[model samples]
Target: MKLKSLFVVAFVVLAPATAAKAFPIVRIDAGQLIGRTLDGVDSFKGVPYAGSAAGPMRWRPPQAVRPWRLPRDAGEVGAMCVQPYSPGDPGVGPLPMSEDCLNLNVWTPSERTEPLPVMVWIHGGGYNNGSGTARLYDGANLSRRGVVLVTLNYRLGRLGFFDHPALAAERPEGEPAGNYGLMDMIAALEWVRDNIAAFGGDPEQVTIFGESAGGVAVTQLMVSPRARGLFSKAIVESGMGRQRGVTLAEAEGETLRSTRARGVAWAQDAGVAQTAAALRAAPAAKLLTPAPSIYGGDLVINDGIIVGHDVVTAFEAGEQAPVPLVIGTNSAEFWWIKPGDDTPYGRFDDDMTPEQIDALAQGFGGREGYDAHVISDVIFNEPARHLARMHAKAGLPTFLYRFDVVSEGSTEPHEGATHASERPYVFDNLYSVRWDYERDQRVAKLMAGYWTEFAKFGDPNGEGRLRWPDLRGEVDQLLEFTSDGPVIRAVPNPERLDLVERLYQKAVREGAVAPPAGEVGTPPQRP
Candidate 1:
């Protein structure tokens, strides 16, 4: 993904003061916070979950937030993590940026009987951009569904994922090096577990969900031992499942860029010395280049400790969390996202004959670019099925989805649902995009229902909703959010995805570019 295309998420927080309660206070592990209440939702925006990852703390694990005595005003959105481009390009104006960005936003119903389920949102930017405070992630509607909603900001770009030899050598043994963004997420979840009760949220029922990059993070959290037991349910929207990862200490064979190599290159380009101190001293502004070296395949570095292995490989070994899971892709998932060598097309870029390319392209006969379909299949849908299958094979409750609901609002929306398009529907924030078509509104309500209900009851299905069969209940079954409503159906574009699957297996068996060895064996807590 150019990622600007993917960060294309999943809210604007603007709201009227009509019938609004002025001040609501909540106490957490950090301190007391004063939030504004409007439209039956109490919102605590820019609440710190952990201390800043700025200055010397850069590239390190997130530390506990320093307790505050005074009530902090969490009404304003927090600073976005250091990254390239303002979120949503020109639509949502400039966003705040900072390294002390380990913050989150919360929305809860003003009235609830028992503790409500908690939903922690990890925004998508292909791991390099996007803020949890994006205009599309507003939790007001979802929170009104009797759940506490949380969205967060984590380090992005080199600030988040870079691994350097000097830093690695200097760091203490057993401390996982790369994947700081993932660490930030774990910290946020931990904060939820330790503090959400004060906000009428039951941390035990936490469901972690995201779109695009955020969806990918959901899978990463599943495979990570550090994140074990932190979340009970997981939802991955357009987060391709089959994408592999590079080892913490190893460079990507396809790109000849070890994360450490990328780290070194990043420092050189920023005109800084290669020492750990110099790297740390480098200006944060110069290091904001987002990575797309290989979307899906390039993120969530497989550190031997923090991250055990790639998502597909780990799940194949039954390493993912054995909890209720929801993973799916859109009908035109890659219409905007570009392809890279790490993708199937990129993997076959050099050796694929015209006959081979034609064989793959034959299945996608239409005005829609076959190139986009192939990339979408291999990078999005194919992996989604494989993951759904594996997760279901464990006899765990797993729900898969194919979102193909395109709004007739305007030509401004993609021709198909496309990547990140389903986000508004999930948050029921179609108003953010001026999409008020009845079909669009209906789909948004259905999506928000499925999502919040899943967070509540571990199942998306509820009264009046169509029965979304489990993946194990039927061959390739999934709950598709469409122009109608949630419908139980077979995986979309199966033949294309199957072909891509075969090609992917062939690539692995042929060992053209093998997955990096990450001291793979087994761990005490699954992956």
Candidate 2:
């Protein structure tokens, strides 16, 4: 069905047209809201999108906001999903942690023409941390680009993603458990579909974009049946699709350990009953503890409900929602290597022999460079290319890119672009991140333009910018952002990607997921 049929946007203007000054009081699907306009942009912060995940709603799909008659305050951001907040975190304010974190923030150009394209940002903190209120994520600058910029928070950690036999048993027969974070994303999109018009947004032209774990979630949304028609375009930065996420149960797939097993074991340690009641009754803090586990942090669970199949599998089988897509990774995401483990060739051990592995190593600049690069290739880089090629082959417009820009105060000796170096520039919030370089502004504008351009039109190409090549007809090229400027170049290492793809396909056929970076085996100490 078309987006027009999907949303019935009826808002009661608090006052008749041409009022002296409206409090910007506009009614939405939920209720009347009052937002403030500043610096040519109107912003509504801490807007409730989903009902509380507290009480009986815990571990279940998000519900609607509890009804309210009065115009609740939309001035400040909502409490962050329960997480440890260090004082040094990005744009973090004094908002306390709570289970009632299903809120979103919207920014709109006060002087824009009617109905703008909406770009909903999903923040990335490895799925364990990050809220929509980070100072760097303030959407004013992007809103100035003539699109509604939305950033939201989803449940995180065990509270966000947990699967247990007991929980499954308690679920209505065939109802999906685990992956509540993904559910929260879908819920937010639904809010946008029905309510974004209140902020002058076009829900029909919505685009979902994210980095790292958020990027991964973007891919999951693309494959989720429930999320299919909610968005029209997608952008994934450093989101890994080739790797397998955990299966809800042993029989689910070949990803990591069954989520059900981990849940049972976690409950047993807490001396809590395996029943859903006992699990839900347990304090939320207990679930937030960070012990080493393969289940959390950018992990996906194939519950056959919310997320039907592996991301790559869905794209390959043509089951994914076909939308204009932009997917890529930074030059060097966080990865490590050690002797003996192939590092996974960092954690994905498979049938490739030493000779074959050596061939792969040479492509990435031989064994030493391979040690540094293979993990990234297997986990982030190659996976991006795989998805782009598949999506393009399906007769959809797909643009692939590599973020090679390095920010100030970067890792010593410059480890290419840090996993998330592009965010500051992507949002055109350089000063917020503490950089004074003039070159960055140009690059930032370029990157931001590419993104907003993609959101406005399904393609990123526009006037006064290098034409971004589409991955439709060819698979060997991509747009790479450099310190000097954005440039399109042949993919860095085709031979390496080829070898990794072959091995990945083999593993998929055999039913196995490569363990996450450092998920298994101790990495050799950083030199």
Candidate 3:
């Protein structure tokens, strides 16, 4: 396949700023010398993409990473932004807390003269937390399969996302930074475009992929004109558009009002004014924590740089990148968000009254109301389906799937495919987890093959793999990844999804969707 080269020259403009070395060791810009440790095949790590987000730059867009006068240590992993996690997942020990956490790692199968395919992975954490350093996200197995794998860390929580009008005013004319995390991803891609060739990766064959919010970010990039030509394909594992719309006015209003309220309350407690300078000078932790709850500072319409519009709006208007896409969700996505033992799909004893059943159903949507089922629908299924539908309607090649396999010895509480469950299988990183290998081993091999196939040829078709279907029609089939083997089946639960589709259409007509539907409209389909 011919690699797209629209922006290859742009990288050349940035190349003079890069080092003149080859694999295992290469220059990123003028200053840094990234180290490498490949298992025979070429793989590199700890390549700085942007300067640190520490101190003053905390909660701001990533700055250019300054090169060290001496060779920087790229061997040890970087600090992961602070986040909450379950007992099984421990925290990164003793890494310094700073806002300057923009960096990327790469892995390749060989150091040969040929430039291999590249896959840049963005980790998922509900717009709040997660790090590229996580064990399950290791790219070793993926690199071994002939693709140069990359994983990166962006600003998270208050440090990566906080925004203020004061900061907006600080912009140089047309540039404003609010979605620092997204900005960090953009900067990383810019670095990749200029530097990947030195790492044995074809800059023209880059595919950006992610899960959950990272997935949402990938789709957002699709709609971002600024991101055009940077990547040739996209893989959004779960984050669809369930919670990704905010106009700059809307976002700014929300931030200003919320920050004022929280700041006033804090001022009353600490006896100080709620002015911008006051807030800025306040103890960083004290000021930052309350800002997110009030203003939702992570992402907002910044007007110029980001176009400060809704993702769905840009996509429907055909402003998004026209790239081959692989998008999908898990079958039992609700299993991951169950609080306590309250699974979304758990059986309810038949002792309930009609009213109770109605209420339960209403909570999910009447039959599928805002209740427990919304957990999966919002985060996984709906978003994935929306991307497929939008791309297919726009005449772009789109592949979809539902991962339905269950690991062997997996208990009922976690019986079906849950969110992020497929990561281990796709990356073939089972060694990082303590799960039973009986069922996982087979599924892992199959899935790893499918993912690598897609990354290699922009299509997940290969010998011994099921013929994956395209997302062209309403009843389009999606590859079902399971232990038995991959099977192309009708998009899962067409009837249920149709019902939800009607709900969205109704909401749109009623103007209930805050981010108004752009030019994109779903033609009425006969049920």
Candidate 4:
């Protein structure tokens, strides 16, 4: 495959007598790209990793970018994939929405003679609404610790994962239908494998990491034969893989008809003909007005090419990529669970009596904490533990964690460590809130140190640091990150995880719930 190249050229302006330091210039497969220096780190942004997915190219697998002659400017972020807008969505970068958003950014140490470990980040917004240029994902802080950090934008929503008979009929020979988003990720990894060395990155030592939906992508990629050998290590944060995937047969007409109908209806509503070409030509804004459901099963499917089987089954069969793993969730991952709403406790038949609520809460310590605990366990925590256990059972070195640090300005009385709260600390970018600056900084340093260390070495623990034992033996242990620092603790509520897993398995057996429908797994959304 012919891929794009990036040639970096750093432009310096100074007096004639003063010799200006040259910036880092690396030649990628596409072309040469010039990256700027920021805080002693060389940064490259808006570098195209694949061809534009606009107009005729939409919904198809990502194509290789046409080689460029001149070095394209790599100083600014590229456009984000078309996605619905949400109020206060911090993950959306300054760039506008476009179909041609298959670009990636890189951050590396300004000076490096030897190839360094690489960490590729996949942003999470429920598979429909995030960009790699999101300020929260700025790789400068992480790169300063001597690793190449990369973040890329992928297809989202219907554009990335829509299935229809017409679409299936149009698929090119040997190309899989659906999962364009995952195909984009695979393409980006292929680009990295062939080109990252020029930027002082060791492609052989790549670590793919992400949180939430991104975490789901990590697990999916791990189980994908197409994604095999693309990454050597994986980190999944709050990603649920217990759900089985719908096979292509299931997605064609069994479970995905409604999703395809939604796409067809949207196309008609937008005044476009119900055809792929017409849909591709439709305005991006029209597509964003009605946000796609995060729970829509079409996003990830067992398409035979990208995902041969459900992740759980693949892992159980030891068919997944054998890579070291670090996976976990926050303590209060599902604080969004509300009273009087359907919950994992088989749902309230009616407005539950206080006594009934209390009874339900008993397994989770009390009513005050019950909803968050149960929901978190079923949706995020337990699934993480299950995946960790699977990796350990397969003899792949596994490290697990539970993030429990409460941010300084949190107003939720019951919030301990909510979803995505650990991101800033992991990136060493604590600009989210101002509560305990010193403590937050310390947490950031500790977390970033652990992550960078993991990228460098398969193990997270290094000399003089807190000892983090790998998950082994009868008793499973997890490193808990708190404001007080890291502490070893037993995986909490093993019985709860077991119960959830059993319930999930029963559902699968009974066909009460369909598995993931595409290459990217979906985190179970609260009903």
Q: List model 3 lDDT by residue over 355-431, tens digit each.
A: 75565455354653334454466445765787688888888888999998877755547456877778888888887
Looking at candidate 2, what is the lDDT of residue 338?
Answer: 37
Candidate 1, residue 470: how far the Cα is off, in Å: 0.8
- Candidate 2 stretches with Cα past 4 Å from truth are 1-23, 84-90, 246-256, 291-299, 335-346, 349-360, 408-411, 515-527
TM-score for candidate 4, residues paired by index: 0.88
TM-score for every candidate vs. truth? 0.89, 0.88, 0.81, 0.88
Off by over 4 Å in 4: 1-22, 86-93, 254-272, 339-362, 365-369, 432-436, 514-527
Give one digit per residue, the lDDT tens place, for model 2 in 228-306: 7999999999887764665555534333465677677778887889988988888887776643222222245776777
Candidate 3 stretches greater than 4 Å from native? 1-23, 32-34, 82-96, 254-284, 287-299, 302-304, 336-374, 409-412, 436-438, 473-475, 514-527
Expressed as tens digits, the lDDT of each residue in 344-409 for candidate 4 is 222421334678657757666676657556666766877788788888899888999999998776
Worst 10 residues of 2 by lDDT: 4-13
The residue-level lDDT of candidate 3 at 357 comes to 57
- Residue pairs clashing in model 1 are 11-134, 11-135, 11-136, 11-137, 12-135, 251-258
TM-score, prediction 3: 0.81
Instruction: List the candidate 1 regions with Cα displacement exceeding 4 Å.
Output: 1-21, 88-93, 249-257, 290-296, 336-348, 363-369, 412-414, 513-527
Selected candidate, larger lDDT, 3 vs 4: 4
What is the alpha-carbon lDDT of model 3 when measured against the actual structure? 0.64
Give the per-residue Cα lDDT of candidate 4 at 504.
69
Q: lDDT winner between 2 and 3, please give it.
A: 2
For every candidate structure, what is the RMSD over all alpha carbons to the true structure, in angstroms? 7.6, 6.0, 9.1, 4.7
